[model samples]
Target: MSQHESRWSLAHTGNRILLAVIAGALIACLCGGTDLPVATQLVILLGVGGVTYALVTLLHRTRR
Candidate 1:
């Protein structure tokens, strides 16, 4: 129905942001050269995710 189409067309910002964060962390993990300890890996993911979220936010702001 047109109602469903309208709802689907309106993107939910929060989900998009979470996806961006996860994608950033995943890309970082895949591209990292060094084999770090589990704890270090967690830290790396956190750092990359934070940076990615910031960049995404900046980009989204600029696009608006």
Candidate 2:
């Protein structure tokens, strides 16, 4: 595929991964993540996911 298409694909994959990770984490929390460690881990997961998603999106946009 072309470079642009490749970038789009990468961004799409990143977005899917981000969503899946967040969803799974939330579900876990609902199931039994009622501890300080779980809460802290959730915060870290969210922060990392957010940054990675943003970076992937930015990369796609800048390449365009």
Candidate 3:
């Protein structure tokens, strides 16, 4: 494998922004004392992450 391909990165600005949004959501849930069950929270987070990944890829390709 190439050295560049082997490294981990959130190299795009869109990716970094999505990461911050995920973190902010977690903090808000914690501070606001949300009553979401563990399973529900996990599903919601995974859904958000999946959608973010898809949107970033879609937007990045068009911009390129």
**All-Cα superposition RMSD per candidate:** 4.6, 5.9, 6.2
> Which candidate model has the greater TM-score, 2 or 3?
3
lDDT of 3 by residue, 20-55 (tens): 568646754664567877777766666666666666
Candidate 2: misplaced stretches above 4 Å? 1-8, 11-36
The residue pairs in collision within model 1 are none
Write the residue-wise lDDT of candidate 1 on 12-34 in tens digits.
56755686678767866775767
Q: Count the backbone clashes (under 3 Å) in each candidate.
A: 0, 0, 0
**Of 1 and 3, the candidate ranking higher by lDDT:** 1
Best by lDDT: 1
Residue 35, candidate 3: how far off, in angstroms?
Answer: 0.9
Model 3 lowest lDDT segment of ten: 2-11
Top-TM-score candidate index: 1
Q: Which stretches of candidate 1 lie over 4 Å from their true place?
A: 1-13, 28-34
Model 2, 1-64: lDDT tens digits are 6555554365577655666577656655664645657667667667666665676667768986
Q: Against the unseen true structure, what C-alpha lDDT does each candidate score?
A: 0.66, 0.64, 0.62
